[model samples]
Target chain A: MQQTLEQKPPVSPKVSAPPMAPTFSIPEPAQMPVSADYKTVGVPLVENAKFAMRDVNVFYGEKQAVFNVNLDIGENEVIAMIGPSGCGKSTFLRCLNRMNDTIDICRVTGSIQLDGEEIYASKMDVVPLRARVGMVFQKPNPFPKSIYENVAYGPKIHGLASRRVDLDEIVETSLRRAGLWEEVKDRLDAPGTGLSGGQQQRLCIARTIAVSPEVILMDEPCSALDPIATAKIEELIAELSQNYTIAIVTHSMQQAARVSHRTAYFHLGKLIEVNDTQKVFTTPDHALTEAYITGRFG
Target chain B: MESSVLLPVLALLCALAFVAGRSRSLAVAGVGGMRILNSLPFYYGSLTAFWCALPSLAVVLIWSIFDGVIIENMVHALVPPAAVEAAGGNIGLVMNQVRNLAAGHLSADSVEPAIAAAADRLVALERINRWALTGVALSFALIGAILAWLKINPQLRARAKVEDIFRWTLLACASLAILTTIGIVMSVLFESMRFFSKVPVTEFLFGLEWSPQTAIRADQQGSSGSFGAVPLFAGTLLIAGIALLVAVPTGLMVAIYLTEYASPRMRNLIKPVLEILAGIPTVVYGFFAALTVAPVIRDMGVNLGLDEWLTISSESALAAGLVMGVMIIPFVSSLSDDVITAVPRSLKDGALGLGSTRSEVVKLVVIPAALPGIVGSVLLAASRAIGETMIVVMAAGLAANLTANPFDSVTTVTVQIVTLLVGDQEFESAKTLAAFALGLVLFVVTLGLNYFALYIVRKYREQYE
Candidate 1:
């Protein structure tokens, strides 16, 4: 066992100790409390906020999906939302770009501001708002077009490129930024769907960045990929956070700790804790966050 | 015994075998317990019923099929050779007369002596045949029931045997549809070959004239019945082209509206009402085309005062094409609607998240993703339009003109087929056989269209996770 531990490359120096500790200290399911209240406002305010969401609530028809949640996404910083499945993390992430408006039954009641301007204002058109805030889905959804066309789709639609050469440059630069240019530059005419899952996801990221959005929202972008592919995307995310504000929803606590600057923990549609990634993973302020990160129950 | 009684007696034995087998299993199980039985009791009962019923039913079927032919041959043998020779190989007519006399529907005074004697023999032969069938069928049923009852034991593997039989029965049912399709193709091919023997294949395919009016009497003037089918093919294309032009845009727009824009309540209400257009019988559409649309078009043409230069016949190709388009709207809209709805919500969200408006999302993402299915729907509508007959028959008169103009009278392949085959026409004439030729060509065209549609759909299908 000692030889095996030395043979494996470490993910992090801090995360290795918790699993090595005795398992008996973990609480039994029967003895644990049935429910725990969450903090409603977990470190909500940031000094250089790119997006400030205060008291957000989301509903799907008669069912409330996300309870009141207040959070701030800082400029050029990666904020990762981590939770169990169906904990409303993805719903909260969608609120950043108002993507939930596409769903007929979904209703939002809160003030979501981008650059101190209210997004839900009566006259605010969603077109330019969405151009400013792009998204990547959990499963890669590239348009059924050529790789070049997929990357150029956004810039073409928003008229970001005035000429064919300009469109070509934007496509090349976006794919390069997403770390897919060298592999796909020769076959730009190939359909986007023909690429591997990892490449397809990168193509989606490239498409989002073609319009040069100020904020990029990603929902489990690497959950559908292999481990090698996941590492590549994680690397891409680390590089991308330098130029754009990123908010990602993930089930992997380790991924949050590795990639994001600020990590937010959600449980049962409520925000439980928000802090720096290392601080939250090493010494969580809330018991629920600790239980989740330690793999007690989802 | 009569066959009607024989059938019921065999069924009764089968039922008895079922009860006997079930009780026998229970009794055998009693030696240990119910768990000792290899299968459930019901399977054993059904297995016994099948064993008893199947062989006996086969015997009955074979006997019934052969009985009529064997009796007819014996009756033919009874008729004196010279008298049968005098009938000039028209034995079928002679059999009909003899059958009428034996049934006592014909007066005895009208028939010849040889025929009357043969009729008596026919009656005797039929009775003997029935008696023989009854004896053989009953004996088979008895043997089967006794054997199956004796075979029923704990180690019989009755469930496995029954399941094997069930599998074979399902295979048999599935092959029945394939076999029927093959049978139709072969019959049409033979008839078409017969037609080609009379009219040269090149002329039938390439010749432009399509006047298929062969004189019934040799003395009748004009109409030597040209077998050229180019005009019919042209007419079919013209009418179908007009129909596709009308249907494609309208159907696609309606689909987009229903799937993308309409409220759920509005969609639920409008979708079925549109589909009701499909449920309206083709004959009803024909009547609507003939009585309403054709007259309206004519009135409009007259009001425009273009009647002097070009007469818009009440039965214009435009009228039938328009009505057929309306008829197939549900076909296109329903299929396209389903495909559009199937485009993943995530793709639409991805586009909307890029600041694309609803219409932009539809055009760039949803429609392109759904393109293969949308094209498939259009091809299906085109096939339906090409094969449409009743509306074309009533509204577009059966005058196979080789012209592309929509306002002129025209006829489709199906309409010409109907007119050529209807009423009193001799089967041996080239005119009647030409119908089969036209049908073969129509089938080929539609088959080619379907294949092309499938090829396009397969080549470009976008598989989403």
Candidate 2:
């Protein structure tokens, strides 16, 4: 058994080297640790994965938007999906909660199971499904209503609280979780649209969390925000992963590296590679993944 | 004939002077002289033309107005004062008859020799006045031409002078429209004041009865016509209310369907058809209401077992109001549709992306966003309903019943005003003067509605932007 382990071939060779460069000897798998509990397989705080997408495919009318893709969103863990523009990362994210159903021409297929139950079943109620899987859009889309009402909209629709006091508690808790309570505690009656972009995005997050969703899907939530706001949101995401499963779609690879425990690399609608964030950045299995990690190509 | 010949000669001379002055300036400084000038060549030509025509036209206009009065007064002076008194201020009528007779259209009977001799003198006076006017006009034209020619030096800056005059002319034209509006308002106010003096202002305003007849003869008894305007106003409101009740919902629904639901091809096809309803002449609608809709409504009421008094009339207010509503539907729908469509598409997307259903989005967001513009359209339609005359005139009854029942015959202020001044009538009577009072009230009401609508629209805009 020791001789067989010593003779095993390397799983990933460094493909980022130039074609004309001198060849280096491939390291044997024996040199790497074989511990049963590796850091790359560190268990998430929540035992069950929240969502498991298997070979998901999406089409927009005649054009294919997302090709066969597979990803796993572990419970109470942050997973970031990052890719170049038009790489179908956002499309893949929208498929998680069936948000793409709002688009008339969009058609999504392949099995996406939440907590081991199929989400796209014909009999399922999309509204309640959306409540369970809340989303924050690229641009902050607070209802053109009062700030308090914007935070209360989802709870009101879902009947999340029975009494006014309970509703207030839910609102306060959600705002607190979104880290927006203190800044907006005074002007709850003002219009939500009057807030800055970052505040509005946070307000949307508070609105989404108000319903006590099991998972939060964020699609470039900080793209329209300033650096300070982006930093705040990144820290919030890190904290949020302790309680809720978070799947963030971002164009910024550094943002993925900074915030996520696991990073999934997508290219041209395909999942090129997904592994532990540090390992995915420092070493990747696929040539496309290696090129993308080193900025050789998208 | 000789004066006509002289007038043309004088006009030709003026035209020649203008051409000569313009050419001389251009010739003095070669071909590029006009380009170097401050203004275009047309300005110089117009300046010369203006100088030539203005004084002459003013003289002619003034002379024409006063010449008739001067000649009539001269003729009256020649007639014996006793004869003028005996004619009982019928002298003007008699003079007209005598002049007709002199022109060889035979009068019914021979006039008195004094009147005939006066008429002949009047003709001679008119001829003399005409000759004097022609001479004055020619002399003025000549003076204007000479002055324009003398002022045509390059240093004179003919363009600037012309532009100055042109600017004043434009201002005067603009003021003409404003003055006309003011004059109309003043006339209405004056006559309304006279009516108020005859009938106390309080009685006219608040009296429940609205009869306006007075006994024509002393022998006739108990023929006092009530001047209370309450019945007419009530009739107007009742009809307009019915119109709005029918129009607002239908128009708004049509607008929503066109803007939100219908496909582009369907909208293009249906919008023109609806607009055709607006283009149909109100008189056509009037006849259709009077001839077709009223009878149908009457039969329907009878079939429904209505009492005779409650039965619809051949000229019921309902028919008029319904037709008027149809007439104004395009006005409301088209305007509202344009405003609704003008709402930014991003607003719709935002609502939809929130997972709200399409109907919910439209009901909760789109309509509220477009409420101000919709209100403006509705107010405009209301004003149109109030001001509509032909439909009310033909379909609505003449009696100004104060009842709110649309099936009953009723009259509006516009119809009453039309009847008051339609045929051979004395303009100074209280009946004729009442038309102005009604007109004033109508104008005030419509103006108030317009201003309120505009205010609502402006306020809504401030909130969003």
Candidate 3:
């Protein structure tokens, strides 16, 4: 049998050579070894917590996206979630304000509390809840109205201001807090979409803060901007963190280190590590976190 | 040679030129020298083919279009002056005799001798013209193929030349529609000019009465019919206004419900059902308007105790306008739904994330963004409503009545035009010519509305991107 096997003709490759010059070969990547029994390694809980989530599992149709995540975000703190693409960081942040409820196929089962009040209660309305916790998206989305109207839209709809001057004051104050009043004050009646990319994001932030939310969620708000625009947004975030609790999702580790107080590393929909930002960057507690920050594999 | 055989030969020659050009380039470049070529081998082949085909096809087209006129003029020159003098210097009649005798449509025994000689000359010139066309077209095709095929080389910019040809081809295709539109406008203008010559423009424009009666003899009654068009214009505006009132609100609500409120599964099932209304023929809608809606409206008015002043006529503007509104619903809702759906998801989410309810987001954010596009759709629907004729002719009466009341019997411009030109009538009569004048007015109005709609839609497109 060994002689017959050795005498068999060599099998040809299934794919023929391309018609042009042959391409250079690249070696295949080695398979990464990720153990299944890993747990959350670093400090997942915090003191004076503003948001407390326990055993959160998110699913779309039958496919589970986030698996049993437990985390806490403290008051007046900025926490950054970092991971490779499609690791459920954005999915976890959307669950805070029940924004996932808009998607018909998405289902979330967990206990999420904001200021010790259940957000996913049977009778809870998303309107008032969203007012208390506003969000800034990856892309700058301004209403196709005047610049002043962009800032005044929320106040007008929520009836926060009783008089026209009061509404004017609210718009001015929000724009001032967002650091965009100086650049856009003269063009109050110009269309909001006519602003530059960075200015538009600042306008979006001002639009968000008009409602006085306690916590602000930002999903890679600087991803669409240039480096100079990104620096301005980072400066804005640092100043805004003093007044409100913030949660940010980022693909850049340097951005996480620069702006966040705490950093959480997620892998394959699992919460791998959470700790102080300096410690998470310098000396991570989990092997996967070390591999990610050290650029071994992503 | 017959053109049927000549055309196929020209096509085959172009194909051969493509192959010859490719082979010549390959032979000059050698195996490894293809890397040094300016463009791909396929571009060279296309260059050769275009050069061979386009000039040959142009020659054939020009020949086909003007060949008869040139041959007829040559045959007319061959006719004797005595033949023309015998026919009272009527050249048209003399030419007709020549063409008939040449085709054996007339007998030469009864015809004049000079006309028979002209007929023989006519037949000979036509046969010779056919031969010249075949010979000249073939020589041009062959010379073009040879020149293009011999010019193929490694360093030739065949790709750029081919792209230049493509640019002109695309320009020709794009201008075809514009040219056709200009042709239509010019024809309508000239006919309306003729109509205005017979009747004064002031009487047609400012006269309030509109009775166009054609009297064949001198002693007939109503010989000179009145041509006032104010009542027709008023009736058109009344019907169109009512149609807009019915269509704008209902179609907008349907679009808002579909885009903002309905689920995807429900949208899929309902959108096609709505578009089915658009697919129904206008003639079908006309009968439906006449048989069903008219009687119901008349009865409702009678039952409400309105017999003399407020009573709806059996053929009233309200019935026609209401049905026309229903007929144009798909145009409004479909276009409005597209613009509303085009409102970015980020804008809607931005509003909702700021504590605004779903309805508030739609009302404040979505509607304001899509407003210009909605107006464009409404204007387009207005044009459709104005140009509509069958339903008005069936459900609305022909008697032109000037009133703002929808219950009164009225006639629109399109209905009047249709009534004036339906049967066998004297094309030279003022009554028949009035139809062309009304057609010109209707054309101008609809064209202006369409142009405004396009401008608005373009402005909306710039707002987003």
Candidate 4:
């Protein structure tokens, strides 16, 4: 690659690079302890990492989107995926839940396992898999429905509650988990669209939580929100990490630093590096990861 | 021939003035000077043509209005006062005879010698009047041309003046449409008021007994023509109700299939074919209803053991309403397809991402978001059904029976209005005037439906935005 670059005529100084190094030491995996701070006790430890992705590659027709990406999502832990635009972080995140199957031209290969069972196996049903791995989108898109009905929709469809009290309890618990019960409990009959953007986003989160998924995937969940709303969502994500494995794709470096325990950096369709959040930010092994974190290149 | 010659002379002068003005400006600042002007050279040309044509056209219009009256007065003065009085209200008849006599054709009726001489005198007077009008029109054109030439200067602000004229012209075009609607309403109101004067307003509006025959003599008539509009109104509502029942669900389902399930190739193929149903003239629909659908309905009625009173006919409301529903399916489906497709894709993705199936997302999110627009489309289609004439005229019978049964023969307001005004009839009679009354009622109903639909659509838009 270095000889090829030296032979080609350079158009601009920005295109030039030093010769590729022959030997560089790949860092050993670090064992970081989970934080002890929490509002509640007796939360279960993330066991054997709930979801494990290995060498996943995604293609949209002939154009490759995600290339040889690997990720391990621990149960009850928040892992944030951060990258610049078109970096395939979202593509890799979508592959874990089989959401990419919804797109007509997208073809995802390689293995994604949930609890050591292959999720992408031909015999596995996609609907139940989706129920186990729910998603929240970038913008707040609450159903044009009443608040009570929006939260109760999934529970009703899955037959999660047999009696009226059970259904009510499910709605209340989900809303409480999302930290929206206090603001919306009095007017549960009001249309969900009538709420503020942040409240609507929380309502959507509660709606997803009502299904009792094992993992929650958020795709830039705070991108469309104001600072205060983003803060509220970050606090909710911290709370949710105690019960569900969470994978968040975000553009804000500071947000990833604040919310995630494990950080994965992607560049140009490749997972350049993944490490403990503090180490990834303070001392990255890969030159691309260092440049991305230090704001030198994206 | 002289007026045609004068018009072109005025046109030529205007064209010359435009070239002169443009060239003079170009000469002042060299060849590229036109780019400096605010408007193009053609605006200046049209401006010159407008000024030249306007005042002369106004004078010509005024002359044409008064010319006939002035000539008739002069001819009348030529005759003696006693003779003119004797001609009396037969003056128009006498004038026609005089014109024939002046052309050397003998009158069909016997002509008195005095009338023949008076006709001869009128021919001389017409010849003199024609010469005077031509001379006056020419002088008016000449004066207008001179004034336009003087005003066509470099600093005349011709572009601004032309734009103002165009602005007023557009306003006049717009007002013409508004004024025409007002004129139609006033005409309907006047005729309806006349019918009401003959038959009391309360009886015409709400009376149960609707026989409208006024006895010409002590013993002149059979059954009287009824003026009670309740039967027709009820028939219209029943038919429209049946149409809505068939169209609303079917159209919405078709819209969902097209927007949500069908591939792009299927959508492109099916949408135009469905819309073609709307373009197939209502008369053709009427024929299908009367010839095809009605017989099938009658056979079905027989199989159901319906009595003679309830037996369907070749001209039954059921057939017409069903075909009309089919005719209006495109109206509902196309509108709904647009509204459904207009729903943000993000909303669909958000629902689907939460582990919801395609059907679930459609039912819970897409349909609710598009509900108001769908309601608006249905209401508009309902208005179309109520106002339809040709379909009901050919398929639905002329018997104005007040019944909810679709199999029974019925007459709607549009059908009755068509039957009342088919051939030559005295417009002054209550029978003819009743058509206007029916038309007025139909207009009011459809207008109200349209306004309500617009209101719903606007309100829903406010909610989402």
Candidate 5:
């Protein structure tokens, strides 16, 4: 019990000692260790932060989806958010670029800053902000255009390419970085959607990078892909970590371990733990995190 | 007995057959119950029901159809060859007069003794035919029911047999609908052929002058009718083109605004309002076109002093086209809106995630994705505009002027067809039969347009799936 006390941070609730549960059967809310007022455990802060969130709360209509949470994405770092379905990990990821603004009834109350600039400010425009923070989704959604146009979509919209030659070069370079230029070079005029699933996702990634973004937020980028396709994406993610900051929300714990440097685990709208990937998988600080990692419960 | 009454009696026998077949199948199954039976009792019941009804219905229908001709042949036998030859051996003419006499619609004094004697024979033969028909049909129904009852055993493949009958019944109904369409088309084709016999096909197809006014009597003075349909075709294309011009942009904008911009409350309020525009009778639009829009356009043209370029008639094509465009806005909006809304969410989000604005996403991703379906919708709308008759009839005047100008009075094929059939004219005239020829052309054009729309829509569906 003393060791358990040491396990918890100072922000643990004052109502009672940390709650404990038996080995097998599902428990009541009271037996759950995490409190409503819980502050995120482990290293949720960093010095070289590219994106940071503080006291964030998200609601879909009357239902609170994400409770108060604080976390930071370091510069050029890969952080994977792992959680059960409807745990608000995706919602939390969307706050970085204010992507949730598109959802009509979803309301977010928090201070989300990118490069010390508050992204959720009323004055900030999402177009430029999103141009800086590109996103890849769970499904490989390539635009219904030829491969050349699909990669050129971002640069054209942003006016980054003054000439057709410039656009072509950007397309080739972006696809090269995404590791897709070799296979698709012969068929640049072919429809982007006609490509294989893995290729399509990589095309989306190339399209994202063509605008030269500072950060890439991916929501389960490899979930729809086959195992080989997923491994290729993991490798791409590893290579991409050298140049761009990435915040990925993934269902696969092993994927988080394989690609991300730091992993954040959320449960029931609260952040239970965020730590170095190896520490989280080997010796998690929070008992709830251990319970989740060992497959006791999501 | 009336065949309508016979139908009910046969239906009652079918019900009895259903019960008998069910019980017999149960008896066949014995202590083993339904487990050992090839099919359930339900299948046996329906199988017997169909057997009892179908064969008897077929026989009764065929008998009723041919009995009139058979009895008429018997009546013809009653009349001597001399009387038939005097009537030019016209069996139909003699039959009509004989039928009128039998019904007492014509006096016996007006006809010769041979004709009167034949009319009496017609009445007797008809009475005998009815009794014989009822006897044969009822016996067939009873025999069918008994045969079906005897065939119902545990080993019988009652389910499969019943299913086969159902499939054939559905196929029969489908064929009937298609056959009726073909029959109507054939009648039109034959009449058009008669019209072509009077006027050359090339002249009707490519001639610009369309003065279809022919002399009423042999000595009467009138213009020799020239059935040049080009002027009518040009007017249709012009008006339909103008309508498309007005409808396509406005309707596409409405669709985009609804799908990409409108709030749920606004969408709900606006969509039904647009549909109400569609539901408003084209006749009502005709009234609006003729009374309101046409005069307004003429006055506006006068105010603008546009007479320097072209004259503006009260029945200008612009007015009809504009009002027609309004009438079709709901169609364009409804159909295109369905496709636009069906633009996959992932595609929209992908563009959005790339930092593109809503309008940019719509322009670059959503619209391009849905373009084939949108073009299909526009084609469908064009077909409707081309086929629209009431507005053109009321607003567009019946002047077959082969001019490209919209301000001049011009007439469409639909309007010409309407005018040709509206008043006192004999069906034998090329002028009257010209309506059927025009109808055939319009049918082919609309059929082509509809087929193209379906093909494009199917192509768009394949892209997404």
Candidate 6:
């Protein structure tokens, strides 16, 4: 049996070679570890917590997408998850508001708590839970309505306001908070879809803020915008972070560094590192994180 | 040659042209290298084949369409003027007899000597005409083949020319449907004009009664038919309204269930079964409405303890309307399902992420986004209901009562048209021509409905990323 094991025709001969190559190899993806467990190489915990996720695993059908992601989101802080495309950053971010429940065949395990309550509990009604945790998508998706109606949609549905005057006030306040009140103040009756791309995104942000959610999740909100629009959104995010605890998933490391208080690095569905945004950029503890930031390879 | 033999012969020549064209191009390219050729060899082959077939086939088509008319005219000329004078200038009857004689279907003893002589001349003319057709068509094929073979060279833009011909062919096919529609509309317009010429336009448009009887003779009494179409219009509206009332809500809810609530497996099982309702022939639904639903409704009214004031007929607009609504449900539901599913998942996510329940998300977001498409579907179903004849004919009696009550029997425009046109009648009579006028009105109403529906869809179409 030992001789046969030794004589097994050198299966996967390329895997035994040295792992470093100066030139980028796009066709053959870099070999990643296949262990059942993942390692946390740097700071992956936080002190003052609004959302604490521990040992969480997500599966789509029979394939595991996220493995044992343990991270914490602090109150009034923006935590940005950055990695290459399909690195499970968006999947982990969606886990906070139970967004993955909408997808059939997606199974999530382990604990994810929001304000010390298990959000994934079967008894939990996602209606109020989602009201508390609003989200902005990668592309702007404003409701097909007037600008005022778009901002008023969330408040009207959740019964956040009773009188017309109060609903108007909420819409105004949400728009003001999203920093879109100045430009769109005169044309409240125009269709929201008629706005520019950046304005449409800000309109979506205002719509989310109208519901008064505690934590706002953004999934690559500025990736679809021009540089000037991205700058405006980044500035708006910075101001909004003072009031709401934010979790942002982005492909741009520079955007994450500019807007987030803490940055988390994900590689092959594992939580590689988490630290202050400045420290992660200056001195990343893991080689993969360093390699990604330096543009050596993803 | 006969048509069967000529077609195969032309096809054989075209095949030979294709081979010759390809080989010529290959030989020309042998010294200059294949790169000098303008297009691939297959395109040259196709160009030659198209050239060989198109002109020769056109000749055959023209000959086939006009040969009988031309030959009949020639044969008619051969029948002497004395024979025509004998038939009292009924040249059509005389020609029929001459044709029968030429075919030997008419016995020689029963015909006149002039007709027999004309029949022999007719036979000879037909035989000569066939030979001339075969000769002219073969020469045209030979000329076309030679021209195409002469034009085959490395410099020819064979691919582009072939593509242009293909584009024209596709355009012709597409225009066939439009031209046919134009033809139908023009025919209806001409006949309706004939109808309006006899009956005043004002009387037809605004008349309050619809008894369409006409006096056969000048002395006939109580046979002057009233041509008021108001009752038919009212009946159509009433039945269509009832159908809309029943179909819209049921279809919308079923669409919502299929798109939002039901699991994938349940959806797959239920969707096709719902569509099977659409596949059922309207005639089947007609009898079912007439035989089953009409009596059931009458019995239900009887069981309701109402007095003799409200009498339920065996055939009611209610019966026809209800089954038409059932028939149209699959139309509404299937179209609505497609548009509702077309509402981007991102919008649903946006609503759900705002903490709204599933019902709230669908009502507030998905429905609003899909409303324009849903209205279009409803209009389509409405036109179908308005145009439906079999159900109304079998279920509703043909009484032109201009009443608003659903329990009374009524007649719709479609039913009136079917009844008027079902049996053989003289086309010159106003009674027969009234069918064309009713058809024109029905066509215009449905056309207006479709235009309005399209306007709504265009004005409110939503954009989503």
Candidate 4 residue lDDT tens string, B1-465: 345465676567567656654555445435556766555656655665676667767777897799788877766665555555677856676676667777778762567776677777777776666666666766665566556555554555668888899899999999999999999999999999998887777766776544444444557774366688888888899888778888888899999999888877999999889978879999999898888998888788878888566756656789889988898888999999999998888788777766777788789879989988999999989998998888888778888787888888888888888888897778877888888988988888889998998899888766655
Name every residue pair that clashes in candidate 1.
none
Docking class of 6: medium
Evaluated at residue A184, the lDDT of candidate 5 is: 97
TM-score of 3: 0.86
Residue A39: error of model 2 in Å?
A: 30
- Candidate 2: list runs displaced more than 4 Å: A1-144, A157-163, A170-180, A196-298, B1-83, B90-177, B306-314, B458-465
The candidate that achieves the highest lDDT relative to the unseen native structure: 5
Predicted candidate 1 versus true structure: per-residue lDDT over A120-227, tens digit per residue: 888888899999999999999898789998898899889998989999999999999999999999999988888999999999999999999999999999999998
Residue-by-residue lDDT tens digits, candidate 5, B176-231: 99999999899989999999999999999999899898887778777588899999
Model 4 interface root-mean-square deviation: 2.0
- The CA lDDT at A218 in model 5 is 97
lDDT of each: 0.88, 0.79, 0.89, 0.80, 0.91, 0.89
Residue-level lDDT of model 4, residues A1-298, one tens digit each, is 9999899986787787867889775432121221222111111123477988777889999998887766677878889888778988898888878888878789988888999989889998777788899999888888777899889988887789999999999999999999999999999988888999999999999999999999999999999899999999999999999899999999999999999998888776777677778888898766666767777555
CAPRI verdict on model 3? medium
Q: List the residue pairs that clash in candidate 5.
A: none
DockQ, candidate 3, comes to: 0.52
TM-score, candidate number 5? 0.93
Q: Rank order by DockQ, top first? A: 6, 3, 5, 1, 4, 2
Error of 5 at A224 (Å): 1.2
Candidate 5 docking classification:
medium
TM-score of chain A of each: 0.88, 0.83, 0.88, 0.84, 0.90, 0.90
lDDT of 3: 0.89
Q: For model 6, how does the per-residue alpha-carbon lDDT over B290-310 read when each residue is reduced to its tens digit?
A: 999999887777787442767
Looking at model 4, the pairs that clash are B210-B226, B212-B225
Best candidate according to TM-score: 5
Q: Which regions in candidate 3 have their CA more than 4 angstroms from the true location?
A: A1-38, A226-232, A295-298, B16-56, B74-125, B142-163, B425-427, B454-465
Colliding pairs, model 2:
B211-B226, B213-B225
Error of 6 at B290 (Å): 2.1
Model 5 off-target regions past 4 Å? A1-33, B1-4, B80-91, B454-465
